[model samples]
Target: MRPFHYDKPATATDAVTNFRPGAQYFAGGTTMVDLMKLDVMKPARLIDISGLEKGRYDFIKWSGKSLRIGALTPMTKLADDDKVRARVPMLSDALWLAASPQIRNMARIGGNVLQRTRCPYFRDTSYEQCNKRKPGSGCAALDGGVTRHHAVLGTSDKCIATYPGDFAQALVALDAVVEILGEDGPRSLRFADLHVLPEARPDRETTLAPSDLIIAFSIEDADFPRSKYLKIRDRESYAYALASTASALRMDGNTIADVRLGLGGVATTPWRAREAEAALRGGPATEAQFARAADIAFAGASTTDENAFKVELGKRTMVRSLLETARMEG
Candidate 1:
């Protein structure tokens, strides 16, 4: 990694106060350090906030109706939580399937959700045509570059890099709220609104400002016992997903009373398939209905030559997740 100054703040207020235009918060450093070593991100200073407020940001609070998880909580803690595993298996499963055991042990939820894309053109400096890395430079993946892992659902002519996180998909599906501590003060917003589509500006990924620090994530209704996260990848383990779905259902006899759908590994952002959920709600919880909903989910997808198959793969992943979730005893 390039030489950079480091600072450890004792509290959130101090961290925010010390923040500068070229400073980055260091938590678990699983993602930031990797990018730094690769020279993909070169910050002037690293503000270490891992021990801020004497670990006040590391916690899990679950009520019968809602769940609040601190941003600094490690992935392994949340994934292994008894209540989270039993009541909200989708969230737990997403965390479990996100990375290896070592990575899970060190990665914080706040950093995981903000992890950058793994697109080859974006990660490697050799390519000069990554719009995400250098705006207006054009996208190399569009010009006969390998695009097997690129996005199809939210692709613009300027970029097709996919958002490669599993937990964020669950958060989007469950309508979780993200709490933030920024320069102005504390604020919260829908997790769905946290990430922005790469429309005209591929370099701009999230809606967060430079000094915004995520404090926690809250789910209003955490009783999704009939929820599941299904991921499809080139390999069985230690690989990024090609397409994945987070599905939750509320059944009323033979009909679907409520449905939630969030897609990952196939979109520009942690995708919430609101259109698909609308189609499945109040409909029969059958393969036929699920298949129809899946089709509606990818109806607006734009694909490249190598990533065209993702459209079909994404649909199948969604259908399977819905069917499997519907079969759950809870």
Candidate 2:
């Protein structure tokens, strides 16, 4: 890792002001430290904001119709919270199914959403061609590189790196709002807008400004007792998803009253399947309807030779998640 200055700011304002062009916020350090060791990220400075005002960004509260989660809250804390597990099962399940116990204990919600892709070419400096690692150089994953673990949805010719996070999928499906602190003070934006597609500029992964720091996420409480996060991978544990789905359902008798769907592991970014949710709303809660919704979700998906199976796998995953959610006892 490259040598860099470190600072621990006690206040959010100070943390935002300390942000420089080549400075990175050091929170959980699970993702940042790994990339730094790989030489994939070489920030000039590291600003530690984990010690910021505790009351402001380290607590979780549920009031009225919304659940507010501080960014600095550890993944394990959120996953184990009774309120989170009972009210937002998908959110809790996503966190629990993520990295091992030690990682969840150290990883924070803020950094988890901003975690970078696990594309081998991007992580291995030996590979000279990686658009996400070095823009304008080219993407090695598109040319003979292993793509079975890459993305099929929202992929561009410039990059096919798969998003490798679980919690972000729950946030997107629940229509959570992200709170950010920057040089200009604080601002809020839809969680769905946090990540950008790997368009022509694959290096630019998110819409966040260099000076912006994610502060918290707000998700509205709803009747989503029948919710689940289903992930499929090569192994049973400690492996990234090949295809995953977050499904929440509200049923009125046998008909679907409302639904929320978010997809991961097969997309370039946290994908909210709004079209699929629209198709399932007010429809019969059955396997056929779920399959149709799944088909609608991946209608625009583009695939490569090795990862073409992901399209079918992703569809099946979605259908299975929906069916499983439907069977849940409220």
Question: Estimated TM-score per prediction?
Answer: 0.99, 0.98
- Taking the tens digit of each residue's C-alpha lDDT, what string does model 1 give over 165-258? 9999999999999999999999999999999988899999999999999999999998899999999999888788999999999899989999
Candidate 2 off by > 4 Å: none
Candidate 1 segments exceeding 4 Å error: none
- Candidate 1 to truth, TM: 0.99
Candidate 2 least-lDDT 10 residues: 217-226
Question: What is the alpha-carbon lDDT for the whole of candidate 1?
Answer: 0.93
Which has the greatest lDDT? 1
What's the true lDDT of residue 25 in model 1? 92
- Candidate 2's error at 39, in angstroms? 0.5
Clashes of 1: 0
Assess candidate 2 and give its TM-score to the true structure. 0.98
lDDT of 2 by residue, 230-266 (tens): 9999998999999999999888999999899999999
